[model samples]
Target: VTVCCVAADPPAEAWVKGGPVDPNLLGATTRSFLAKVLTSLMDRFEQDDDKDTVAAAGEALAQLAMLLGGPGVHSVTQRLIDTCLQLLQQEHICQSSDDELDGEEDHDGALWEAVSELLM
Candidate 1:
């Protein structure tokens, strides 16, 4: 997986949704096409709190799951749940200071909520 779905720089929007490169150009298949695509994209926001990207990731994941139908989707969905939960754990760890923790008061909740909403 490509670490960090996106770089913290200009035109960051490309990391999640629309950008210089269009994902539509690539066809989805059983192989690692979409997985690698989303994996790379999600890896970007993995450490970043940008809830917008997280929400977008959730949507993208759902679409991928649907495309990879049956238990594959369920399996992928479950893995996504695990991944989101892990990210929340990491976010908690990164909140070393009280102020930082307070700042992210609802950050974890919101992130998971978006993921859950997407799954549901």
Candidate 2:
């Protein structure tokens, strides 16, 4: 019923490592929560014109992608692929150009690297 109830209840092993998550894992509700978190991070990255939040959001997405694994990634279709592709194409764009409004420094390399690593 609560955010804490959902996130904290999920087995930590499923999220901490990107190894093969159990096929018969996560209830429907939990899966939906994962979908929301992934979507929210991607959306946050898009809305956040600032370099810091954008970069942070990207990092969060990358981490989520990692834990989610191949099976876990079935939820996000276009958004995940688009973000990954964008990072591939603009590897150095963020590092060079950024709005420092929120004191979030830019690291183009990290963003690209994070996504790449996630998909790996």
By TM-score, who's the top model here? 2
lDDT of 1 at 15: 30
Model 2 reaches what TM-score against the true structure?
A: 0.56
* Local distance difference test, each candidate: 0.47, 0.56
TM-scores of the candidates are 0.43, 0.56
Candidate 2: stretches off by over 4 Å: 1-25, 91-106
Off by over 4 Å in 1: 1-32, 70-79, 86-113
lDDT of 2 by residue, 1-120 (tens): 324534655654454454555533654555666666767776766555444566677766665555555445555656667766665675434534554433332354546556666566
Best by lDDT: 2
